[model samples]
Target: MVNLDSSIAFLIYITAVSSAAAGVTEACKSVIPFLATDYEARNDCWEDHNHAARLNHYKRFFNLLISVVAAGVIFGVMGLDPALILTGAEKVYVEDSWEVGTWLWGIVAVFGSPFFASLLKIVEGFKQSVNNNLPPNRPRQKVTGPRE
Candidate 1:
């Protein structure tokens, strides 16, 4: 059985880990789109106003890019199954000695809040863009004439 203090420490550790995970999630959400959009806008200016082409030209707009690159390292260092880590829903066959459930649960709480906040922001951004019919990070286009 783990000591009370140790259990508390472990819980804190898990919370910290989850916070780190959340940070990465937010960073990826923000960075990837910024990169892709910038790339797409530049492509749009260079080429004709081919919105179709710009839309079709997909880019790696997520942390999956980094995760894929570090697959080997992540598994090697953590001694975890790469497949499991990649999936994030992996269950290991380790025996549970102490009741450290609180830590894992706490991690979810600590991480989930910011994640949801960021997600809401992203959603709001999308909603605004769609509502106004304008590109993100740019002013909404003015209505020129009556809609058909």
Candidate 2:
């Protein structure tokens, strides 16, 4: 089994869960007609600014709700323990009947999905930077004769 206590492993696990929640939100948008509407009105005709604004607000709320529900299902019903490590602190796992941390993490995961890619990019860049800054190893010299 994978060790969730490790930083890298936890990062991968959270990212996967967040991406899955995002996918679920997208799927919900496709299946729900109201959630899929892009125009100001359902008929795809231009409507009053206020009406369009209201629709947009409602759509955003529903999208967030769907994302949260998806995350909850992933973490709760799926029996996946929600865990995270803050800074250099010890690992934190949320395991309880109520699963408050699970829901909280679910919300964070759903909202943070968009930024996860960027975060991974940043991490990769940092690793590359560190690797580049390290001194290169000296090539071994050929010893044609006995060492001095």
Q: Write down the TM-score of every candidate.
A: 0.28, 0.66
Clashes of each: 0, 0
Tens-digit lDDT string for candidate 1 (6-44) = 333333333344455545555666765643353334454
Where does candidate 2 have its weakest 10-residue lDDT segment?
A: 1-10
lDDT of 2: 0.69
The models' CA-based lDDT, in order, is 0.42, 0.69
Report the C-alpha lDDT of model 2 over 1-148, residue by residue, as the tens digit: 3332244545656788888888998998889988888645445555666688788889989988988878877877655554434233343444552467678878878777667667666666566666689654569887687779
| Clashes by residue pair, model 1 | none
- Using lDDT as the measure, which candidate wins? 2
Candidate whose TM-score is highest: 2
Q: What is the lDDT for 121 in model 2?
A: 65
The ten-residue window of minimal lDDT in model 1 covers 67-76
